[model samples]
Target chain A: MRIVLIFALLFAPPLNTKLGAQQKPAPLEEVKVVATTVLLGQLVQTIGGDAVDVDVLVKAGHDPHRVLPKASMLLRLKNADALIMMGLDYEHAFLPALLEKSRNKNLQDGGNGYENVGKRIAALEVPKSLDRSQGADLHPRGNPHYDLDPENVRIMAMAVREMLQKVDPGRSAQYQLRWTEWDQAAKQEIAIWKAYLKPIAGRNLIAYHNSWPYFAAAFQFKIAGFVEPKPGLRPSPRHLAELEKTMQQADVKVLLMESWVARSEASGLVKRSGCKAIIAPLLGASKQNRSYLTSMQALIEMVGVAHGLPTIQEFKRDAKEEQ
Target chain B: MMAPALLAQQDGMSQGAERRFDPAWNPAIGVALDAFGMMVGGGDGNNEANDSITLRSMELSLSSRIDPLAWAYTSIEFGRHEGAYEVELAEAAIWADQLPHSFSLRTGRYLADFGKWNTVHMHDRPHPFAQGVRQEFIGGSLAMDGVELHHWLGIGDLPVRWSVGVGANFAGHGHSLLAAESDEDLSLGHAHGANFATTSAGDFGLPGFAWTGRVSAQHDVGDNGYFQWGASAFLTAAGLSQEHDAGATTELFELGQNTLAIDLTWHRLAATDSSSDTIGTEFFWNQRDAVDETFDRVERLQAVGLWGFYLHEFNAHIGAGVEGAWWEHADKDDGGHWLSGAEAGRQVAIFAAWKPTEVQRLRLILAMNQPDPAAAADSILAVQWSATIGSHSHSLDW
Candidate 1:
């Protein structure tokens, strides 16, 4: 009996020492936060600064829509003080199972430590009615790709700051200061990006999926149509023909697509419609695109150049020449 | 700024209100339907009856948080059995989630965590049919009315989980799991008693309760692969007892059955594409003991089953797998002579599945089974269609 008791105690889960023994107050520990996507992780890291440790579940270049949390990911979540996610069913495919298995009450939905950045932000392209025939990729709450827009990124950063402050009250001031700096810098960057996109502000564009609606809305570009007939369904030949007619009628000259999507159909569409197809990274697809600022800047430069607008660098150089 | 307003209208939310739970909060409700068409050859007396299309099972599942400290899950299955529509309560359990020392407790009827496959639901199984030893020994599954306690821990960053449970259920001849038979009718084959044993405090009887325990450890094999190994054991009284006398010596004997199993699984998904692969194997050893009419004589019946399968996903929509299983049963009589029979068998099956969406699946399976002492083997071809609506399939910690 003594051996059995000793064996169980040795193999028990790591308990919270402070909670177990209510004697002296334990020192504040670093807040460990787990984010569902690379973009969200970047936002959390930027705003939390040195006050928190951030772990990302879905790595760069992977589609957040199809991720299955691995055992390692679950381990990261088990010790998390808070969970930050782009919730409008964006991570629904994997998050529920992971949370259920993690058995971490702090990170479960409705818990004090759960932070859904997209919950408070307004959503785009929400379906009016539930329809599975729309190709099973429909987001009932709204489009969860809002992180593609710089403005939404700012909102998400603020949400992360709020979550950090709640989880680690002792570092609230530190988090607030860092968040203010990031917010001002992000606003300035958005202004600059808007200036770079001025020449093609109202230009009509085509994209391979509905991934760009929030982005187009933020940049003041008009989306003429999508290559896919619906959200996740592939474009049939007839649908492509109809899209081509729409593009020709609107005189659309740029077709935007993500790097992960197959280029065959987008290339065919560009050839038939006489448009330039610009493939852009949706998230941090590479190390160079790891930061939210760098990824957003790349997206703006790609779209601006594809639409025949001068690149930001060229525009600045030309302005200097004029001065 | 204008984008937020546009999206607010797009999502039909008020200017300041966010998506939050209201007073009428309810859990997600889901239903799954499974139907199959089978063609079989060389099954002794049931060949004609088995070669037909059947609606195998329709399951309704409900899951919700009962309170801040508890969660509940219930699944009810309705299907056609013996040309009659039958309804069975598959699982109805409530779990206490917030316990000290990373422990949790669950109570009510649930599939006992006996082996790798017993805890899984039928619709999610790789093969359409249960393995032979599972059907003969445990009656396919052991869903007992019981309580289970689970604990989770990590050893130097490697996750390990274990559980212990006890339950009271009818266990004996002709008492198949999930079948329509009543508990009172499940007797110990006239050797014990006319009525099955009960676990109620007032009627507490010997050999009435079942006990089970399991332990598992998991580790990451590589950047993209995970390996898990588990061991489980189950014990129960078969309720079969007898009294024997030899001259001036008298003895009372009872039947007891025990099973031990070990399983290993490796799963990996390609980092670049949707392709994934899983390989798993399980070995089981079961023994049943009974004393003979001769006061001092004892008999032992033992069975060993080994099963393995490999599943691979070629892409997002298609998957294929092959599974094989073998079972050997040995019985030793009072004379100490070992006897083996047709109960020992081997089966091999190959199947391919097409999943058009995450909630729908279609599968084609071909299987061959050879039973010991049988003149010829049996072959089967079957196609299965399964779909779920309203919620994701209920999954346990894999």
Candidate 2:
């Protein structure tokens, strides 16, 4: 009877171990993705969700134009399972160097894990000619700010969804599920943005640079002229005078500027035109705007406020009270 | 030893869409015109920068990718020779990437990745004058014909690079920037080592041509600051004279050389690339075997030099800076022959620059030069204009 008890105890250990293995499965390994910009990081995180870990190459609040792959950025890239980029040579003059220096062939152009979201969208404002003298900064590739158009973002989401599934097939269903939910959220937020900005519909806005064509097209706003005579050149006094004339004619009340652009150049225009200037950061400017949809909502809310309309926050509070 | 390949920094003048190099130029061609007019010694005592407004070092560079794995670059320079223009090959090398273990290989006649200053061409210096320490110890620049292996230590967060090089014709120094005709400095050539080559009877010379090793790295100091540091060592031997015998060649008088250089540079770049402030310092120590013309025998002489500078760019078009360079004989000043002329000297300068665009710059410099402590200081003014008309890529020495 004692030997029988000992045999049962020893065999019972193996029985419990087998039951533990069968009952509690291990979690799938998360794919590591290195995304170039804060906006792209937000997009990757949305689609990857819990199945992937996203490392942002260009940290938030830093100058987006100043993306230098220092050691830290490079190391993260080297270890990444996939890399997401905003193509169209969007100051990606450093991309070739980064890939070569990282010595990670998997992230190169032809590699399996390389993803360029630019390919997913049809670009706007593609120059007919590559004329260097025509303007201050004419991108040879069409406007890369297509993501500003929420529709283009949906396209980018599809591409990201496919990329994550390809890199981490075991979590394909999880990524697809997150993508589906993200699509719904984006659609709802975009509708709110359109309604919030409806008061200023068809109003021509003055922008410091050529960053807002996609955004203007997506919303109901009209863009008359820029503070800069050309796309990237400083606004000459003559150009500013001309732009002011256009602003008066178009009744443009908002002057939208990028955060990296110097404000001193546009300060005179602000006073002369008496238009409210809105400085839109690249992305992830405020704590509340931590994600892509939130960042876009924040930008839309600012424009609404500038036009003397209620912000999205007020709109949400009113809806809650109604309910 | 390794020039940090600075990522494409949007030159504020370039606006947002400007590509630093014109990729449209199929085989990327670059040209630079460097001309400066300075004191020509208009003051109290002898100092450097005696050239009287000369257009020197017009470099024409050509580069193309050799294949998927390699690229070749060649630079030819045209300068005044015997009161006429002559052309010389500055650098011609092929760099191969895609090697195993983050290794890159470069082979040809190129600047030996020696000190930070030695690797930078004269056209790229902020000021027109070469720093005194590096200029006196190793001449304006040290070019080598051989192979260099570079390894990017993908260690942790910082990008650390180590490079080792060995080759012949680790020729003497830069000729255009040199003061005058001197044996220590030789003309650039594939067989330049032959200038100092002799028979094997003088086994004093090392069989290997020249050897160099360097380790360099950089890190971000703050939100808008970058710091780069480098340490380098170089060794080479050359024969001073060869005795001719009746039938065979005789023993040679060989001078063994060793050089060590350390440098640190910190840059406070504006949020955009519109403006920046730079503060930098470089230290050099050189020990060499040379024929002491006084005693007519080989003597080991050591020298040390230090240079520091602070430069601030007010905006895109304007900048001002102050630089001071000092060097002296570390060994007893017994008046050696080969290097005695440049013994102990110091130069200080304050200047302002007008960079109208990315490709055009004009600078006005006011400098005080004292070759020796006992000598009178020479005050001089310089006006320099530099222009680049094509795509130029400099693996930068930031």
Candidate 3:
């Protein structure tokens, strides 16, 4: 009786172990991807979902154009399976150095694991001929600030989805499902944004830099002129005097500038021109602008409030009450 | 209703259309020009032909990806020589994509991967003048016609990169192998006698081949700080040969030479503004072996140099820095006659630069040098203006 009991106990343990192993599903390893900017990182996260682990090189509130790649960032890139960048020379200042030092062949230009979201968008402000004499801050391919427009964000999301499917063929179905869900959400939000921003349409505005041409084009806002004399060139006294005349003639009442740009120049212009200045940071640059949807909503609300139109929040509340 | 119609129009225009790939495939071309005016005075109160304004250098550079596997770059420099414009090929190299097992190759005439300062061009250097050690040992821009193999070792989580190279005409005129006249040598003419006159393969009395290697490591110290350190070595069987018996008989003496250098750099970005601080230092030890004419025995001559600097960026458009350097030669029974008069010396320099934009810069430099043990110290004040046109890509400094 004792020998039979011992044999039963030993057999039972092995049987239980095999049963547990067979019942559990194998876990999928997430693909690692590195993005050059915060907005691109957020888009990659939204589209990639659980299929990818994303790392952003340029942190929030920092200028993407002036980011200096660190050694730790390169280390993260070394283990990444893919790299996504906002091409068109937007990251031209620092991305090239990081890519060369990473020594990761898969993430370099022409590599199979590389994707440029800017290439997917229809560019704006493209020059007929590019020369340094025109300006120091010229982007040869065109304005790379397309992400400021929600429509362009949708296009970028599609590019990210395609890249993920190509990199992880086995998980294409899961990526497609998530991409569809995100597309639906983005479309709904974009409709709301267009309605909320309608009040500010056809308004004359002034920008501190050449960073908002795509946004202006999308919203039907007529940009009077930039505060700077030219792209990346600081304004001289004479140029500033001429800009003041143009601003007054256009009846511009609001100045838009990024958070990183010095407010002194914008404030001075505001004082002289009797216009209000609004800090319109890029997406993911602040806690209020965390996600893609929230960032777009915030930008619309800021512009609407600046022009004395109803905020998106007020509109949504009113609509809900009417419904 | 109007908003929806407007958005619909935007949507119609935003359709994804494939851009012509061939039209976008263009090489990046850049031109950089530097000009400076200077006034120099000696403490001994003898100053003539020391005040002048001249164009320092003009560099034309072009780079492009040749294919999926390689990229090519070339830079040509034009400078004034004897009141005439002279052109020289500064750098022309092709680098390959890293292959299996993390290895890559670069070939052609290129600046050797030595210390941190040797790879940077004159216009880009923080200081207006080259380091005393760099001028005395490696010369300005230690370029060599060679093939370099670089490998990145994935050992632990630390970042370590290394390279090994071998080249021809390592001791030639254009390539400053063991010792050759540099652009600084031509410009200053104070350290001309300190360098060995073996400027070609025939002068070395041996096959003019040299080998160089470097190992560099980088570490991140805190959120916005970084540290980097590296060591480099160069060796060649080429050295200076002299005639015996006062030009009566020439001896076929084979000579050997080598150089060793170590460098350290620390950089920190300001937490509140666009300011940053960088501290860097490099030390060089150069040695040469030759048969002494009088002793009839092999003798080794050595020179040691140390240079250090601290640079600060006040803003996007303004920067300032200070640098100090010291060099010494081993005194032998021959009273160190092999070294130039000003080779063993020390100097201190301070500079400030104002850049209105990314492409234009104006800088002011104040320098004081104490050359030759017997000569009095001298001071120089220089104003430099620089401009660049076209695309510019920053290289991997590590």
Docking class of 1: incorrect
Residue B164 Cα positional deviation in candidate 2, in Å, after optimal superposition: 0.8
Give the higher-TM-score candidate: 1 or 3. Answer: 3
Best by DockQ: 3
Candidate 2: tens digits of C-alpha lDDT, residues A1-323? 99999999877777667777666344348788988777777888878877778987656655444444455566677788999887876645346567667878889887878999887777888888875355535577898878778888888888888888878777777878999999999888888788777767888898887888999999978889887666555566888899899989988889987666767878888999899988764466567776788777777888888778887989878777988
lDDT ranking from best candidate downward: 3, 1, 2
Residue B66 local lDDT, model 3: 85
Q: Which digits, one per residue and each the tens of the lDDT, describe model 1 over residues B160-191?
A: 88889987653321212111112111111111
TM-scores of chain A across the candidates, in order, are: 0.86, 0.84, 0.86
Predictions in order: lDDT: 0.73, 0.71, 0.74
Which candidate leads in lDDT? Answer: 3
Ranking by TM-score: 3, 2, 1
Q: Compared with the true structure, what per-residue lDDT tens digits does model 3 show for residues A1-323?
A: 99999999877677667887655343348889898777778878987887789988876656665666676777888888889988988988778777876777788777778998878778888899987667777887999989878888888888888888877766777778888999899999988888787866898988988888888888889998988778877677687777789888988878887766656666777899888887765566568787888877887787888778887888889878989
Candidate 2 per-residue lDDT over residues B189-241, each given as its tens digit: 12223222221122334544678988888787765567889999877665234
Against the true structure, what is each candidate's TM-score?
0.80, 0.81, 0.83
Report the CA-based lDDT of candidate 1 relative to the real structure.
0.73
